[model samples]
Target: MKKFAMVSLAGVVTLGMVAGPATSLASTHEDPSTTDYSDVDTGHEEFNEGFNIYLALTNGDVILRQGDQRSEYVSDVQRLLDTRGFSTNVDGIFGPNTADSVRSYQDTYGLTVDGVVGPNTYQSLSDRHPYPNELFRYGDRGEYVMEIQRFLTEERGMEMAVDGIYGIETERNIRVYQEYSGLQVDGVVGPKTWDSIFTYVR
Candidate 1:
């Protein structure tokens, strides 16, 4: 009887050891390094599903479709972030990974990460782009603004200061150029006005 009891005790201990590992595995999940976000939520339950917040800001409309264009914009932003050394899922869904990358960018650029790209965020992204970002700006204070000032003063012969100051002088020169180009003389360089300026300057 003692021998039988000893064998039963050994069998119970073996079962417990096997069950312990199984229990731990049941409670644990795969590490994110091996996990994929494409298999996760698509960020559709909340606001406009595929409408990228940044493009909406640029176009003066809120995107509500999680379609190809939205995905493209998100992909572009993610690519920018990746170039900036922030690794993200890049799944075209503006979820936690994208939000975190935006926060990282915001923190670096002194922006507020309420997760919405406003004027300041847009300016920051556009001003520091890798290539010449002349087409996507509207007179914010930055290197491109300085470049615009340089173009106006040197190429356009406006006798204006190239100090990156969007003061009355700059506005006047912009309006003058707009009138010359038969634009609306709004003193603001929209896409069409900007294209005209470059066409004339070049």
Candidate 2:
């Protein structure tokens, strides 16, 4: 009888060990990593962080969409699309033409063909044609300088020629705007100045 009882106890212990691993495996299958977000909206907070980081790095904070008002953010997207040979007006307006261009860009780039410029679309655009991050000083010249000229003229009420030349007038305007905006007033379009300008524009 003692031998029989010992054998039954050993069998019970073996069964418990097998059951423990099975239970652990079942729990692991229900882990949060396996959770499905398919039913959730793509615009939810969970999915916007990456795109928000992209915008913050690029000095943009708005998610552009159709029928949105004219702003510098829209102009940035339009410029990016044009740079990629998508050919849309850089008019700072999210019109139908811009939407069609965005869709075409999305289709060509193997992104979702949604007309909205969401995080994924922005990532693809940035990957292909990154925004100019070079420092712009008094002697800089190009489209970025022209952008500054336009910003000073249209947003800050400064009368300057948008001729893509960062001459004395542009530097002076930058310093004045910097002083007025309570920035460092360095007269250089560095990250801080760019952020200040984009923050005000957006």
Give the best candidate by lDDT: 2
- Give per-model TM-scores: 0.33, 0.41
Residue-level lDDT of model 2, residues 1-202, one tens digit each, is 0010011253342111221221222332333223443342222242233334446535445578899764656776786688668888888889999999999998988988989887678756755212245577765555566766765564344666787656655666676667566788666787767766644422
lDDT against the true structure, per candidate, is 0.48, 0.60
Q: Write the residue-wise lDDT of candidate 1 on 71-91 in tens digits.
A: 655664565466457676677
In terms of TM-score, the best-performing candidate is 2
Give the TM-score (vs. native) of candidate 1. Answer: 0.33
Q: Which regions of candidate 2 fall more than 4 Å away from where they truly are?
A: 1-84, 89-97, 108-111, 119-136, 139-158, 180-182, 194-202
Q: Extract clashing residue pairs from model 2.
A: none
| Residue 150 of model 2, lDDT score | 66
